[model samples]
Target: MQLKLAGLEDIEDVLTLHRKYQIDTILEEDKKDGFVTTNFTREQLTKLIQEEQGLFIARHEEAVMAYVMAASWQYWSVWPIFARMIADLPKLTFAGHTLSTENSYQYGPVCVDKAYRGSGLLEAIFEFAREKMSHRYPVLVTFINQINTRSYRAHTQKLGLVVLAEFEFNNNHYLELAYDTSKSLSLHQSTHGQH
Candidate 1:
C-alpha cells in the first residue's frame, strides 16, 4: 500500500473515516459522560485540509485510511472568541483548552481504518510526521487517553517519545507525549534520496 498527503480527490474517504470513528465507537469519554455529542462534517474537514494545519490521507487502491492533525500549528491562532466557540460545540472533548496554551504542536484525532489495525501503520503515521516535525513545530504534543494502551505503547515504546504530563478534562485522563528533538534524533535526518 502507498501513503500520501490527501487531496480533494480523497475527501469522501476522509469524511467516511472521521464519521466512522466519531459516530460508531465511543471515541470520547465526554460523550459517554453526557457532556457533549461528538460530531464532524465533511465541509469542516475539507476546509481544515485546505488550511494545511493538518495531514489528510489516502491509501493505495483503497479508501481513505486515516488522518492526523496538528493541534495548533501554522496558520493557527488562540483567539479567545474562537476558543469559546469551540468549547460550546457538541462533542467538545477538548473542553478545558485555552488560548494561553503551551509550547509544542499538539496532535489531535489520529485514526486509521479498522481493517488495518495491526499493520504498524499508526507507528508509521508518527514517523511520517515526526520526520519533519522536529524542526517544523519543534515540539509535538498529543493527548492519548491513558486507558488507550495501544496508543500509549506506540508513542512511548515504538517511537521513543517521552511522556511529559497528564491532563484531565471531563473526567477523562489524557497522557501528553512529546517528541524531544534536542539530541541526535534520527527523526531530523534528511530522507531526500530514500526510495
Candidate 2:
C-alpha cells in the first residue's frame, strides 16, 4: 500500500471509504466487525484539504484503502462533539506532558477497508501520519467509543496510546486517548521493528 498525506483530489475516495465503514452504515450484527463514529462532509473535507490540515490516506492499486484525520481546535465550531472534547482538554495529560489546545491536535475517526483491517495497515497509516504531523504538534489526542473493542485494542495495544480520561456524550461512553508524539515515534519503531 502507498501511504501519504491526502490532497484535494483524494476527497472522493476518502469519502467513499469513510461512508463504507461508518457505524450507521453497518448492521448491529456487524458492529463487532468495526465502526467509525463520525461522518465528514465534502465541504468539511475540502476545507481541511485546502488548509493543509491533516488527512492521511493509504491506497493500494490506486484505490483508497484507509484514512486517518487530524484536525485543529478550530474544527470544534464545526462539530459539537469536538467542542465538548475541547472543554475537557485542560484536565488531561500523558507521560508528564499536559495537553493544551495549542499543543495538541484532535485525531481520529480513522477508517480502514474491512478487507485490510488486521493486515497491519492501520498501524502503518498511523505511523505515516505521526511522522508528518508530529513536527507541528507534540501531542495527538483522540477519543474512542468504549464498546469498540477493535479500535480500543488497536489504539492502546498496537499504537501505544494511553487513556487519560473518560466521559459520556449523548449517552455514549468515550475514552480520551493521548499520545506523546516524540515518545510515540520511539515506541512505534521498537514495537513495529522499523516498520
Candidate 3:
C-alpha cells in the first residue's frame, strides 16, 4: 500500500471511497466493518485540497484504500456540529497543552476500506497525516460517536489517542479525543509503522 497527501487531481477517487463507506450505504450488521459519519462535498474538498488543509489517502493498485482528514477550527462553518465542538475545545488540554482553535486542528471522519481494515493501514495513514500536520499545529483533536466501538478502539487503543472530553449533540453522545502531536508520535512509533 502507498500513502500520501491528496492533491486536487485525486478528488474524484477520494469521493468514491467516501461514498462506499458512507453511513447511509452500510447495513447495521455491516457497520462493524466500517462507516463514515460525514459526506464531504466536492466544493468543500476542492477548497481543502487547494489550501492543503488535510486530506490524506492510502492507495493500492490505484484504488483508494483509506482516507484521513484534518482541518482547522475555521471548518466549523462547513458543518454545524463542529461549531458546537469548537465551543467546548477551550475546556480541554493534553500533556499541559491547551487545545485552542488557533493551535489545534480538527481530525476525523477517517474511512478505511473493509478489505484493509485490520492490516494497519489506518494507523499508517494517521501517522503520515500527523507528520504532515504537526509541523503547522501542535495538537490534533477529534470526536467519535460513543457507540462506534470499532473506531473508538482503533483511535484509543491501536493509535493511542487520549480521550479529553465527551458531550452530547443532537441527541448523540460523542467522545472528544486529543493527541499532543509531538508526544503522540513518539509514543506510538512501534505501532505506527506496522504494515
Candidate 4:
C-alpha cells in the first residue's frame, strides 16, 4: 500500500470510494461502520488538490483504499460546521497550546475501505497526513458526529486524538478532537518497532 498526497489524477477513484460510504448514498446497514457527511464534487476536489494541497490517500494496487483531508481553517470556513469550529478554537486547548487558525488546521472526513478497517491502515494514512500538515501547523483539529462511535473509537483509541470539547451544530452533536502534529507515528514506530 502507498500513502501520499493526492493529485488531480486521483480524484475520480477517491470519489468512487467516497460515494460508497457517504451519508446520503450509503447502505442503511453500513451506517454502523461509519459514514462521511460531506459530498465533495470534482471541482471542490480540484481546489483541494491545487490550492490546499490537503488531500491524502492510501492506495493498494492502484485502488484508493482510504483518504484523509486536512487544510487550513480558511479553506474549511465556508462550511457552517467548520465556521462554528473555527470560532470555538480559542476556547479549547491541547498539547500546551491555545488553538487558533495560525497554529492549527482542520482534518477529517477520512474514509477507509471496509476491507481494511482493522488492519492499521487508518493509523498509517492518518499519520501520513498529520506529518505532512505539521510542517505548516503545530496542531490538527477535527470533529466527528456524536453518533459515529466507530469513528470516535478509531480516532481516540487507535490514533490518540483527545476530545477537547463537544458542541451542537445545526442540531447535530459533535465531538471536537485535536492532535499535536509534533508527535508522529513514525517516531513511535521507530521506538516500539511496531508495523
Q: Which stretches of candidate 3 lie over 4 Å from their true place?
A: 184-186, 189-195
**lDDT, candidate 4, at 163:** 94
Return whichever of 1 and 3 wins on TM-score.
3
Worst 10 residues of 2 by lDDT: 186-195
Q: What TM-score does prediction 2 earn?
A: 0.92
How displaced is residue 102 in candidate 3, in Å? Answer: 0.9
The reply for model 1, stretches above 4 Å from the true place, is 23-39, 71-103, 181-195
Q: Cα deviation of 73 in candidate 4 (Å)?
A: 0.6
Full-model lDDT, candidate 2: 0.83
Error of 4 at 119 (Å): 0.6
For candidate 4, the TM-score is 0.94
- Report the C-alpha displacement of residue 82, candidate 1, in angstroms: 11
Mind giving the per-residue lDDT tens digits that candidate 2 earns over 168-190? Answer: 99999999998877765557659
State each model's C-alpha RMSD to the native. Answer: 8.4, 2.2, 2.4, 2.0
What tens-digit string does per-residue lDDT give for candidate 1 at 22-65?
63554564233211123446665565567653664537576777
Q: Model 3: how large is the Cα RMSD against the reference?
A: 2.4
lDDT of each residue in 1-195, candidate 3, tens digit only: 889888887889899888887888666877876577887889988888777568899978878889898988896456878998888878887767777888888998899988788887887898889888889899899999888888998888778888988899889998999887875454665656522
- lDDT over C-alpha atoms for residue 157 of model 3: 76
Query: Each candidate: what lDDT?
Result: 0.54, 0.83, 0.83, 0.91
Best by TM-score: 4
Worst 10 residues of 3 by lDDT: 186-195
